[model samples]
Target: MLNYGILSTASICARYIAGVRESKNGFVYGIASRNLENAKQFAKKHNIEHYYGSYSECIEDENIDIIYIPTMNAIHYRWAKYALECHKHVIVEKPFVLLKEQAIELFELSKKNHCFLMEAQKSVFLPTTLKLKELLDTKIIGDIKYINLSAGFPGRFPEGHWMTDHASGGGALYGSCTYTVEFLSFLFDEPSYQYDAHFIKGKGSADDVVHFTLLFNDIIVSSVISMCCALKNEAIFYGTKGYIVVKNFWKSNGLDVHIDGNMTHFDFPYTSEFVYENNHIQECIEKGLTESPVMNKEKTIYAVKIVEDLYKQM
Candidate 1:
């Protein structure tokens, strides 16, 4: 079994641990934090076997076959690079890195080290998302002319939290829009043809709202992401024939397809939305693959580039 070491005590780590337990070929072997006590508590609470005070110690542990980095957006590149250099397979959370160059550099380092590396984008590995892609490929909704994705919630972060700090990779674009960009890349099997974006920042805060439009040849895609407001939180693909609606698109377990005034609903219930991605990672490791065929390097680089360009416009 692949022994997984997690790099944070963030709330998401709990969910990731649950998913790893549900996975077929992996387990949470350890957890690490900047504080030794925090690491110990997290390890005990999650039933992890090992705990380390420093990230370096965790990555250096020979027993850990994979290191999962769920740290902040800005530091993902640093820890991922460190783990890769240590010859450990790495899984980095979404918004892989702040810059496209960082993404390229990390992938190159992974290759040089002969280690597996993937951005942990659970949305694309979700069953609902896979079904959506299948439907699009089969033209179940005819030709898709336009796509609309809206994701947001009234998120309240504590004062000085990284989520509201632009330098720390805070803001709606890094936090939520990454989901839309990576999701589209996965569905279309290509990045957007071209794109433009607009941002809204509150006083002394990062961009709280973002509206972006992308063109994929004949198809037009529009998206709005926010941390300061509530949205419908769904994705709609408008086709020549009809449209498909995916509720909670980021962690969706079901979707509804509308065609000919008929609506068909599909559900794929799961205990943990992250299990699929965890299983995929193990499968790749077992196959001696250095990169995921689905969430490959090119898609990651393209997604990061899209965000980078949007940030440049900000």
Candidate 2:
């Protein structure tokens, strides 16, 4: 069994702990935080076996075979690099890093250290997403022409939240647009794409709202993401003979496909998408794989590049 160690007490950590429990091949071995009491409390609450007060201590523990990082966006490169240096496999939450350079560097380090590294992008691992890809490959939707996707939420975070701090990698592009970019990259193979973006900055240097149009192999895609407003939270793909509309697409819950004026619906009953991601991590480790086939390094780098380019345009 792969013993998993978590490096933070972030809200996302709780969900990960639950996911580990659901994965028979792994368990939450330990948890760490700057605050010892917080770590202890979290460990006890989740039935984790050990707790540490420092991230370094947790990663250095020889018993931990994998480290799950769900920390701030800006710190991902740092923690991921450190974990790799300690020869531990890592699974970091997405938007992998603030810059494409960091993503490249981390992947190199993981290879040098001969350790596994994966981005915890639940969308790609979802059954619904896999089904969507299968249908597309079978030409269920015919020739692709355009895509419209929007994902966002009304800003409710208090001041000084990391989601509002640009230096901490806060912004709609980093926060929610990762999903859109992943979808586009998944649907289309061409990494060469052109895009134009507009941003609305909020209280901090980060853009609360980001709108963009992209062209991938002649397929036009438009997306709007925000932390200041609520959008339709959907992705619509228009094809020559039919179309597919997914409500709350990122969640991988359900989708509707229309062909020749006939509508067919698909619903995923699973609650926690992280469970699938957790299983994938363990399966990779068991097979002596250094990277996930589903969320591979090339595609992850492509996704990050899209985010980086959009920011540059803004």
Candidate 3:
């Protein structure tokens, strides 16, 4: 079995850890956190074997072959580099790093170490998202005119909360919009953001709302993302013949694909699709592949560029 070591006790690791435990060829052997109790709790809850008080200790575990990093956004580059330097493969949470330069360095480090690295971009792995790709490629939507997507949520983050702090890379655009931008870039093959507009947050140190337009090969895509507002999540593709409406862009839910007067509803059962990604890690390791096609360094770098640019503008 492939052994996994989680570099943080963050909630994001819980999803993938659960998936890895359920996979026949994968398992999370250990978890590390700044708080010893936090690491112990996370490992015990997941029935994992080891709990390390420091991230360095986790990476030093020779039994662990893969490392999952879900810490704060700004620390992504550092932690990923440490993991690769230890000769362990890595999977980092989205909004990969704070800058494209950081991403470039991590990419080079992974290659130099001959270790696999990928961004944990969940959208592209969803069944609905997979279908969207086929539809767009076949021109099922017909003469794509525009694409609209938005995602946000409300939370009571206290003062000094990373979400509202600039140093922590806190903001709605990084935490939420990264998914939208990454998927759009993937489906449309790296569309250029020709037109841009946005609404800056009145309180937070980072962007709360970002409205941007991207030009695809032959289509225009418009998107608006906000964190201060109420919950609103959707990915709408407008085309000459029809449009596809994905209501809940983050999770497995019902999405509609409309063609002319006919509407097709997609019912997706919410299980641990995150684990499916862990399976990809296992397959790559077994076959000696250094990167996952679904979440390669190129896509990760592209997504990082979008976040880096958004932050620069904000």
Candidate 4:
């Protein structure tokens, strides 16, 4: 089995750990946190075999085939680089790194070490997202005209929380806008586009509210993401012949298609949304592939560029 070591006891790891435990060829072997107590508690709750007080200890474990990094965004590059140096494959949470340059460096490091590296972009691996691509490619939605996507949630984070600190890579732009930008970029095959964003600050220097518009070849994708309010968390596409709508687009198992005034619903069976992405990672590792075909390096860099540009305009 592929032994997995989680680099942090962050809440996000819980979903992925559950999925990895269910995988036929993967399991969570170790977990680490800055605090030994946090690590021990997380490991016990998740039934992990090993726990470390530091991320370095987790990556240094010789038995770990892969490491999952869900740490704060500012430190992702450092940890990922170190994991690659240890010759361990890595899967990093979204908003992969703070900059495109860092992504380039990590990809180079992974190539040099001959270890696999991938962004944990679970949305692209969703059955609904795959079906959306298939339908768009087949022109089931005809010529695409416009797209609208929104994702956000009102959270009760205290002052000094990472989500509210700029130094910690906290913001709706990094936490939420990344999703909308990635969705549009994937849908259009990384087409040449123009992006602009407006923001509202909440706690940290980061923007809690963001509104952006991306101009594609023949489509205009508009997005609004905020930590100050709750959004429908849906994606809508309008085309010449029809349109498509995905509710809960981030973890959806089904989609609704509208063609010629008729609506049809499609569903895909799975235990958890993370299961598909975890399975994909396992297959790639077993096949000796270094990057995910769905969320490859090229697209990752492209999405990073979008985020960088958005920050520039803001």
Candidate 5:
């Protein structure tokens, strides 16, 4: 079994914890947070045995082989680097890091330490996403032209949340648009793409919204990720032949394929999407692979480039 410990008590852990608990090859051996009470309560609620008052404790614990990072958008690089230096495998939550430099450095550290590392991009690992990619490869959507994705939640965090701060890596792209970028890169090979971005600053630490357009060779794709106003979420891919509409990219529960105005529906597997990711991580480690085939280093770099470009625009 691949023993695991969550590095944060953030809400994202709820999804990942459930997935690990449900996975046959994984176990949530421990949990850590800044607050001892939160750590203990999370551990107790999940039926987890060990709880640590700080992230360092979890990293130092010998029982855990992998550290699952579900921390804030800004702290990903720091904790991921710490986990690697400690000789622990790492599965970081999406967007991996704020800059391409950080992503490259973490990958290098993993190689130097002889440990496995993976970025937790959910869409690429979920069965539903795989099926959609298969369809795209079969020309189900014909030659793609434009894809639009929008997602936002109103005041999901506190008044002065980091997501509202630009320096805090606060923006839709770093926070939510990672899913949309991952999807496009997955289908378009992550290369031969150009990007553009704009951000709307709010009173918080990051931008309230982000708008970006992607160029895949000759194809044009656009996405709008908002966070300032009310909550709304949607993703859809348009092609020469038809389009696929996904209700929520983050949840990734279901989708609709439309061709010539004909509709076909697809529901994601009943199994937790995060479970599939956990399963994939263990399988890669067992196979002695450094990264997931679906979300390999090159693609990881490509995804990072997209983010880097967006930041430049902002």
Candidate 6:
């Protein structure tokens, strides 16, 4: 079985631990935090075998086959680099790194170390998402002409929270926009056409709202991501014949298809959305693969490049 080392005590880590438990080939073995007490408390609460006061200690532990980093966005590069240098397979949460250069360097480092590495994008591995892709490929909606996606949640970060700090890679662009961009990249291959983006910055220096448009051949794709207010949180694929509506597209378990004035709903229920992603990681490691074929380096770099370009404009 693969032993996973968790590198943070953040709330997301708890959810991740729960998901890992559901995976067939892996389990959380250790947890680390900046504070010794926090580490101990988290490990105890989660029933993990080991706890470290520092991240380096957890990475260095001989039993840890993989290091999962779910820290603040700005610090992801540092910890992932360190983990790769230690020759441990690594999994980093979304918005993998703030800059595209960092992602390139990390992949190179992972290759050099002969260790597996992947960005933790659970959406693409989801059963519902895979089914949606299959339906699109079969031309259920006929020739695709336009696509619209929006995701948003009310901003409720506490004072001084990382989500509100630009330096910490806080904002809708990094926190949420990456999802839509990466999801599009997965559904359709790397975009070859032109694209443009606009941002609206709120009280913090980071962008709270973002609107971007992409041209995929003759098909036009538009997306809006916001943290200031709640949106419909849906994705609609407009085609020459009809359209498909995916509610809560990011982690959705069902979608609706509209054709000939008829609507059909499909459901792919799951106990934990993270289980599929974890299983994929385990399968790659078992096969001694250094990178995921589905969420490959090329796809990751392309997604980051798009986001990086948008950030440059802002």
lDDT (C-alpha, whole model) for all candidates: 0.91, 0.85, 0.78, 0.86, 0.81, 0.89
Query: How many angstroms is residue 98 displaced in model 1 relative to the true structure, after the best TM-score fit?
Result: 0.9
After superposing candidate 4, which stretches have Cα over 4 Å from the reference? Answer: none
- Model 5 Cα lDDT, one tens digit per residue, 27-51: 8899999999999998898788999
Which residue ranges in model 2 land beyond 4 Å of their true spot?
Answer: none
Sort by lDDT, top down from the best: 1, 6, 4, 2, 5, 3
| Residue 176 alpha-carbon offset, candidate 3, angstroms | 2.3
Put down candidate 6 lDDT per residue, 1-314, tens digits, no spaces.
99999999998898889889999999799999999899999998889879999999999999999999999999999999999999999999988998899999999999999999999998888998898889888998899999999988775665567887788988888887667877877887656647799999878787788899988779898999888878899999998889999888888899999999999999999888889999999999999999999888887777778878888898
lDDT of 5 at 310: 70
Clashes of each: 0, 0, 0, 0, 8, 0
lDDT of 6 at 59: 97
Q: Which ten residues in a row have the lowest lDDT in candidate 3?
A: 193-202
Tell me the tens digit of each residue's lDDT in model 2 across 131-215. Answer: 7887777888888889999987885666678888888988888887778877667656435678889999998888999888888
Full-model lDDT, candidate 6: 0.89
Better of 1 and 4 by TM-score: 1
Worst 10 residues of 4 by lDDT: 176-185
**TM-score, each model?**
0.97, 0.94, 0.93, 0.96, 0.94, 0.97
Clashing pairs in 1: none
Q: Judge candidate 4 against the unseen true structure and give its global Cα lDDT, from 0 to 1.
A: 0.86
**lDDT of candidate 4 over 105-203, digit per residue (tens):** 999999888899999888888888889989989989889999989887787556778888767878888886667767666766867778788988886
Error of 5 at 115 (Å): 0.5
